[model samples]
Target: MDLDCFKAYDIRGKVPEQLNPELAERIGRSYVEVTGARKVIVGYDIRLSSPEIAAALSEGLRTAGANVFDIGQCGTEQVYFATSHFGMDGGIMVTASHNPKDYNGMKMVGPDARPISSTNGLLAIREGCREPLGNARQPGELFQIDAMKPYIEHLLGYIDIDTLTPLNIVVNPGNGGAGEVIDALEPYLPFEFHRVHHTPDGNFPNGVPNPLLPENRTPTSMAVTASNAAMGIAWDGDFDRCFFFDEKGRFIEGYYIVGLLADQFLRKTGGGKVIHDPRLTWNTRELVQEAGGEPIESKTGHAFIKERMRDEDAIYGGEMSAHHYFRDFAYCDSGMIPWLLVAERLCQSGVSLSSLIDARIETFPASGEINRTVKDPEHILQGIERRYLEEALSVTHTDGLSMEFQRWRFNLRMSNTEPVIRLNVESRGDIELMKSFTRSLLDDIEELDGQSLRDPQLSVAL
Candidate 1:
């Protein structure tokens, strides 16, 4: 078995080459063998290849003597819901999640919807699937079912229905699986949705549903401005993570959303614990402290965050990449819950989204995540650290290498799932300083990438 498709968190790869039905089936058997899960729930997203892969996975699971619940065409979060809500031993979601057309992947969770990742279990599954030594047992039962209505009701529970105000909002599912849930929640809420790319088109006529890209965000931004919405929200293909834009059509960084949400939850819960990733930390830490909440720092992946949240009995957990987790929700991340909480915050505060985040923006300016394909990411990271170490105030490797200076700090790390390095820079109440250092860093990266260094500040997109 060629295990090139197995990643740190999930199994993702290009179709036919890296992922196919045979591999998925073998993986399904491996999952049951490795986890000893007798009951499994399976789902797929709005990808052309997802259905076939899911079918094969379910077949393999059943053949391995595990009963399977076939919840067709749902978001990754729905699998989390089914796994924990029904008390199943395991769950699998077939999705590439913002990857290009030829790509597909799967996310798995053990009992209680807790994540299964490389640090804990993924690599072991990879090893188990090779050679398929498990003898065939009597096939287990497979049942078809729908988990949407229950999932939507759970989402509504995150916000009080009576407290919501009538506000127009722009919603872009990007032709992914989120449109279904949004439509289901419409009749129960007072908000009018300006829906775009609302249908689940597997071919993705509007391109893959990744709102993190600057190009992918323009549609949502324009829709917000044109519709005069209170805010705009966009989700990835699997709808596991969601992005935000204010009424003025300005994109809000996911890092600040972490702080904003921490403020809202902390105020309501009256000083509980909140877990945050180590990527862009200053704001989240300060916001949690100011709101009288304890901020716990965790490593920058779902598995790590979930583990830390469970250890601390945290009320909530957030990552700068838009993944939000709730203790009430089995410590699994949700794309739906975060936005609902934000909407409730807007309603209660009676303030525009831009105004709500303006002060925080000015107080902690940041360069949004920038990615560059590099030949040797390790070399560049080492070089950057060597150049900045002399003047650094503190250095930490909570997730990646994070170096803090007097006025500014940045994190440079390799993506666990992609062939690129991600860079994030921020300054304490100084946008110019952030901009200048960001430029300097990017220039260094370009030179390290073996390309002729052009000016990194050609335009200030952030």
Candidate 2:
């Protein structure tokens, strides 16, 4: 088995070649050993490889002298739900999330839905798999359970759709696992659903079901405009990330949604702390403050943000990457919660999604995030700090490298899971200045790294 399958957040790799049933079984046995859990729950997505992986993993878990309860074909969130709902010792989800169809991965959760990343215990699990557990095989009973209905009820209890007014909306499930949940909730919703590719198709004929890419969003945007809907929403493979589009079929930045959701949560929770990533908008901070809640900033990624939320006892957290974590949901990020809040807000206020987000658009102008590849990522980051951040602003190396100014801020960090460096720039409502400064910084870094734009393909990919 390839060791590269163990990633920063979870175990992921190309299916068949890098990831297969044999490897998944090893991981399952390794997880049971490292966590020392007697019983483990398992869940999977709609991907074709998921069921096989789940079965193999269960076999491995049973071999390790542990009981396995299999919740067949569910979303990643459902796996988290089962860990806490069924009172299991630990759980594992068979999914690659938003990655392409050729890839597959596993996400592990400890008791109470606590995540296990590489730095936590993933490496130990990997190393434990190296030595085989001979003659330790034990057969455990397998049973099926429907975790979806209870999970849906739990979500609806938190969001009140009855207070919403009637509106037309389009939901593009992108052929992932969200279709069933959306279908189950439609009858209770106060809106018209113009759904596209809502069926769960693991083949992903509509191009991987990732709404972040412009190409993947074309279908959702077109449906929104054609149906004359108030807005459009799309989800990733496992439905962990949700992206939005306006009435005119324009994609809204995820940063703004963060502010919108934070505002709503603060209103209901009576000014609890809200957490946000440093990438996109400071408007989230301003909104939290205005709502009488403390705002906390953290490094990007679900693991980092979730850890901070737990420490601060935050009510809500959002990242520009479209991951939203809620206090009610075990402090784990969910793609389903943000849209539910948006729908409820639209219903109660009698406002369109576009109109609700307009005020935030004017307040927080961002250049979005840009990624570039370089040989020496650290050297380029150091050069950026020396040239742009040394004299005028405060700099911190929390996740990557972040520099703050009075009116403008930017974060330049290397990817923990990949070789590329990511740059995120934001300013106080000045679009042009943000663009100009971003280009200048990119040019400076390229010159220092002695690299040039070798691939026009990168531009097309973004």
* Backbone atom clashes (below 3 Å) for every candidate: 0, 2
In candidate 1, what are the lDDT values of residues 89-145, reduced to their tens digit? 989999999999899999999999988888778998899888654645688889998
lDDT of 2 by residue, 210-315 (tens): 8888888889889999999888999988888899998988899898899999999888888999888876648898888988899988888888898999999999
| lDDT over C-alpha atoms for residue 296 of model 1 | 92
C-alpha lDDT values of all predictions: 0.90, 0.84
Q: Return the TM-score for each candidate structure.
A: 0.93, 0.94
lDDT of 2: 0.84
Worst 10 residues of 1 by lDDT: 453-462
